[model samples]
Structures are given as structure tokens and as C-alpha cells.
Target: MADLPRILVITDRTQVRTTVENVVRAVCKEAGCTWVLLRDRDLPPLERRRMAQRLREVTNECKAKLSISSDAQLAADVGAEGVHLQRVSDIDGVRALLPKGWIGVSAHSVAEVRLAKEEGADYVTLSPIFPTESKPGYGPPLGLETIREASAIGIPIFALGGITPRSGFSCVEAGAYGFAVMGTVMRASSPGKVIRDYAAAFATSSSRA
Candidate 1:
């Protein structure tokens, strides 16, 4: 596996007024984002595939990797770099589909993170680290302590949920390998600037470490 990106951009089409491709391109080109996870799973299969294809083209031009969210077959069909699984049940299935590609999962606890690692997932987004509108129904926030424990399990943990440029450094101090963002970037008026801020945060964190 290549060195994972310090910031993972999760897409939510509903949060943005413009097209996802434009946002992704801006972030990739300006913010220097190297990875994007396409998460518009509510779309019809054909539409999702088409969007994935378009995103793949856009990401390619920006020298970034595109990973389909929770759809291994579609990811394979589109030649994506990987797939981000929503549940552990899909790990084994996805492995067979993208043998050499990255496989990540969404985990909410230490046990779940352990399970993902044991199942051969390359990494995980341990989410809800802070209260956020993005996933309000995901129960209470897991908090930074969860990242402290989950990172010890040996998987590269990306702290998700309510992570912003200001709060992202705290996650790194707590032992997160990286952090993921959805609404923050997707809903930003200047998505590229947001990405640039995240990159700066990570750089500062790395230096202090």
C-alpha cells in the first residue's frame, strides 16, 4: 500500500450546491488532496457508476485516487483504487474484488476497529469524534479517547465526524494517523481553502510529533 493521504475527503452530494466533480477537482488541485471517497450511494446504480466514472476522470487529471464508498463491484468496474466498506460483512467480499487495492472500513469503537484490522482492512475511519450534523443519528460522539485506543490496534485510523482544520490536530495528538471530513469540505464556500487548511494542520501536527 502507498502512503495513505493525511486527509480523506468524503463526498455528500446533497451538501453541496455544485457538482461533485468540480468540488473534487478543486480540492485535489488546490488543497492537494490525494484521495477521495465517493459516498453518494442513494443514486441509482447506473447514475452512481456514471458519476464514479466522471470522478475517476477528474481525479486522474489531478493525480489523485478515487475509492467507491461501499460498492466493491462498481469500484472494480470503474477501476477505482479501492473501496471503503460501511460494514465488516463486506470486507472479505471486497478483498476478492480488489486484491491489490486499498480497503477501509467505518468503525465506531475499539472493538470494531480491531475487527476491521483482523479482517485485513488496510485502514478505518473511526467516526463521530465530535458532535456534528453530518451523522447526527450515529448516537453520541465517540470522542478523542476512542482514537487513542483504536490506533493502538495497529490499523491506520482516520478520525471522522465533525473534524475541522482547528480540531484536526487534536486527533493527531491522540494518535490518529489521519482524519476524514464530509460536510466541512463539501459544504464549504471555498472547498480548496478548506483542504489547504487541513494540509497545514497535518503538517503542523507532523512537525510537532
Candidate 2:
């Protein structure tokens, strides 16, 4: 529930142009990404844990926060800054598992956002504000209205999906706390630039608000 950075870089193994670890290293080296989530859901637990360990080192070297998606045990084992939940059913159980960890969850609808708030999610990412290549077939784009609606519910709502510096400010204006992105950062030749651009936009928009 502490102040999370305005820019969050979500790492997906399947979406990277190069190796996942290399992408993380390059992005962090660029110096704009404040938090990075290791979110490869298909990898076996051992492999995921290994990748998380490597990412933790990268985050440490860059003085950035690192989190593992959907694996509280591994997050605790790796001493991550936090754990994000995608499919966890019981927040109470997760809270017990991660007593001191920062928590975030994915919310698709306003109802889900309220549920997440009740369940004690520190933040929630409301997705598909625009069409996103990283996540296809999940559903149609939720649009900026989802962010606007969720913002009224009180949890810090992060807009995810097809976010860019130009479009990011629209999300902030619509009342999102920040942005979470994957494909844009993953496929970028200069991920640092992308992050810096988005961060700048967020700062300017937040100031105006």
C-alpha cells in the first residue's frame, strides 16, 4: 500500500524479443523502470523460481523493486519486494502467506475492483484500456472507462494494455493511478526510452491533477 512507482514494467517470457533475463537487464540498465514483475505463467515452478532469482539480482543491482506473479512462496523465498496475484482465489490465504509483502491484483470489472479492495489488494491493474498484443483473446478491450469506473472504488487502479506515453496521460486524466505495460517494453529496441517517456507523461498529468 506504499506509494508504488508511476511506471511498472511487466515482464513476460513469451513476449520478449530476446531472452527474458536479458530484456530485464537491458530495461533496468536504462534506468526508468521502477518496478518489474516476472510474469511467465507457463514456466514450471522450478524454472520460474530460477528466473525470479535472476530478476531479483537485476532489480537489486538497479535499485528497483522486483515481484513474482502468482507465487507467494517463491516471492518469499526470493525475498521479493512484493507478489502480484492473477488467479489466486483467497486473499486471506495470500495475506497469511505474505504478511509483510506489498500486494496487487488484476481486476476486470468494477465489481472485481470492489472485490479486490475488500480483499485488501494494495493496488489493482485494470486491463485492456487499449488493444494489446501481449494479451490477446482475454476479451475485447475494456477501454478507458474501466479505469475511470474503477478509480471511484478507492483502490489504486493501474491501467494496463497498449499504453504509450501519448495515451498514458489519458489514463491518468481518467483517474488511473498509473500504468502497467508489457509488450511495449518487451519488444522495444530502447525500453528505457519507452519507460522514461511514459514516466514523464505520468508526472505531468499527475501534477495537473
Candidate 3:
């Protein structure tokens, strides 16, 4: 696969509908970060599908890939590009539910990452390269060394957790294939500019490397 973009914007419908979705979409578009993970833990099944469809419509306009979280069937039904499995156990089940071309799991630890790779995940997310607001009480952030170790496992690793526009480039420098964000963009004064800055920093680093 071509080098993925430096950012993956995750949208939780419960947390990111209304204004947040607009801001995130705008930011991801400007940054050329073309992958989004749409997640909503509170929505009813029907509502979740509806929201997924809406997200697909919005993301497609920017030519971004939309990956629904936890619901492979719904993702396929709504024409999403993939599904993000939160746990290793869900990997085979979700894979069997979707067709051949969709994306799969992202694990947080070395063992889980290995399992994800073994299970045929399209990519994996290793998190908390620094403290993050989205996941409180998830223990101290894993830091760059952990991310680098996980990245060496030979699967694409998207560094997640507490990754701000300022620290986003550090994740890339540490060998993360990309970064995934929730609060940084949602909480930004200008989400679009935040994305642009992160992307620019990653591009600059890429050129220097």
C-alpha cells in the first residue's frame, strides 16, 4: 500500500456529531488525512447504521475512507471502507462478516498487536504515545519507545492517544505509520488548521528523512 497519511481522525457519533463532525471532516480534508473511524457506543443499532451512512456520505465527498467501529455488518451494509475491531476476539468474527476489501483490527499492546497481525488485520493502532483525554485511567501513556517496539512487529501502526498537533509529528518520528486522534481535533480552536499543521510537520519530517 502507498504510505498512509499521517493522521486518522476517529469520529464517535455520540461525541462527534453536530459541530464536531463538521470540524473533523474539514480538518481531515485539508490535511489529506483520508481515513476516519466512525464509532458510537450509545446509538441504537438502527441509529448507528443511519449515522454510519451519513458519515460515509460526508467522508466520501472528501475522498476519505470511512471505517466503522465494531460493526462489520453495518459497515458493509453502508458501504464503509472497513471496520475497526476493538478486541482480538472480534477480529475473526468481523472478518467473516465483511467482504474481502475491508480493513480490520487495531490493538493496544504487543500481544494484541501480534494477534491482530496473525488474524489478518489491515492495520493496527498502538496508543498513548503520550497522555490522552479520550482515555482517562488507561494507565500511563505508552510513550515513544513502546510505539517503536510495536511498530517493529511488521504491521502498520497508527499511534493513538493524546496525540496533539504539536506532538503528532513525534509519533511519526518514532516510527508510527500514522497517528489517530479524537480529542486533539475535536478540542481544537481551529480543527482544520490543526490537521494542516500536523500534516505539514509529517511531510517536512518525511522529506528530511
Number of the top candidate by lDDT? 1
Candidate 3 residue lDDT tens string, 123-195? 8888666777777877678888887788877888888888876777778888878778887776666777877
Give the per-residue lDDT digits (tens) of candidate 2, residues 55-137: 99888988888877888888889989788897537567777877877788988888888988987888888887888777777
The C-alpha lDDT values of all candidates are 0.90, 0.83, 0.75
Off by over 4 Å in 1: none
Structural similarity to truth (TM-score) of each candidate: 0.97, 0.94, 0.89
Worst 10 residues of 1 by lDDT: 1-10
Q: Write the number of the candidate with greater lDDT, choosing between 2 and 3.
A: 2
Order of models, best TM-score first: 1, 2, 3
Q: Global CA lDDT of candidate 2, please?
A: 0.83
Candidate 1, residues 1-209, lDDT tens digits: the string is 34888789989999986989889999999878999999998999999999999999999999999899989999999899999998988888888899988999989889999999889899999988999998888868999889999989998999999898989989999999989999999998899999898877778987986
Error of 3 at 109 (Å): 1.5
Give per-residue lDDT, candidate 2, residue 157.
90
Per-residue lDDT value at 27 in model 1: 96
